[model samples]
Target chain A: DAGVTQSPTHLIKTRGQQVTLRCSPISGHKSVSWYQQVLGQGPQFIFQYYEKEERGRGNFPDRFSARQFPNYSSELNVNALLLGDSALYLCASSSDSSGNTIYFGEGSWLTVV
Target chain B: AQSVTQPDIHITVSEGASLELRCNYSYGATPYLFWYVQSPGQGLQLLLKYFSGDTLVQGIKGFEAEFKRSQSSFNLRKPSVHWSDAAEYFCAVYAPWGGYNKLIFGAGTRLAVHP
Candidate 1:
């Protein structure tokens, strides 16, 4: 049983560019969430999706969006990235939107210059 | 709103010594608490959780936590620390807001173990 997996482990983008991070959840998982972790800070909630529907969103701006597929995989996209957007984008998977038994992926390190 | 606080930014301890990490939470109802550990450049790993039942819960890697509703705290503890125990410890609480259950994490405490 593999855990949640994320890709583009490290990336660099221009301040005005856009970026997308992907995640694959555990086999039986049905919920997927995204989090952002800045340097020297803990991970903060971003978005959560269950059954291909947006269940909850954090305090992030409209520039950030996410979608979950039928297979419970997810993608987090950030548009017009700014220097402040440079952080570790983490994807977590849980059994459901109830937030029970969630697990996290290694995360994608995004650096905007 | 639900929130967590880790008063200690960093803590250093010697190997074979007991360790305690303080965590305080603010929530309306009985809180669903959890402790997570993250190594450098790694994702968060579940150390333990307190939902209901016994106040003291034992977790993997010899870690344990006790929930005290009176104090609004869920502190992580270990009987003996190891060099590998050096990592960032986070306290979190599950909240039901925006029609979905979410996790709110603390600022995190960095742990350093010395020989």
Candidate 2:
């Protein structure tokens, strides 16, 4: 089975612009979570969606938002992007709400210039 | 607040040598712990996890971790290192509080395997 998959493997945007990153969870997976990994640092949680509902959110700013589709796919939207937002945006998917063992995608590398 | 700490930012070990990576966590309740490995430009892969069973839990790829409640630590170890083991390892904690599952990740420790 294919693991979690992300789109736009690499993206470049200017400050104040908006960007949307997409993720398709593994077949039969119901939970999807987003994370941001800055250079030299581990991934920091951004948002998590389970059964098309927002389950949890991290310390990210309000400009960052996400939603899950009826099919369990997810999109992370970032508005008013900043230079600091240049990082690897990761999408992880799991089978349940427990969020214990998640499968991650290669991640979308977003660069805010 | 729940947090994870990986003391060593980078570690180098020769192939066939034993390997150990330390992880420490701070949480009020019994936190769900995990260790993930990430290859260059790849996504993170679950190496193993410790929930509520034996202190020593075995995981994929011949990896194991020991959870010590007294020290608030979960350290990953392998009997013999392989060249393929050269990757970034992250320690994470899952706190199930208020019906929300949030993961706290450490800065990660990069393992360098020298042949």
> Which lDDT values do the candidates have, in the order given?
0.93, 0.93
Task: Report the C-alpha lDDT of model 1 over A1-113, residue by residue, as the tens digit.
Answer: 99999999999999889999999999999999999999999888999899999999999999999998878899999999999999999899998777588889999999999
Across residues B16-46, which tens digit of lDDT does each residue of candidate 1 receive? 9999999999998887899999999999898
Q: Report the CAPRI category for model 2.
A: medium
Candidate 1 stretches greater than 4 Å from native: none
Q: Taking the candidates in order, what DockQ does each have? A: 0.82, 0.75
Single out the weakest 10-residue window by summed lDDT for candidate 2 chain B: B95-104
Model 2: residues >4 Å from true position, as ranges? B97-99
Candidate number achieving the greatest DockQ relative to the actual structure: 1
What local lDDT score does residue A12 receive in model 1, on the 0 to 100 scale?
A: 99
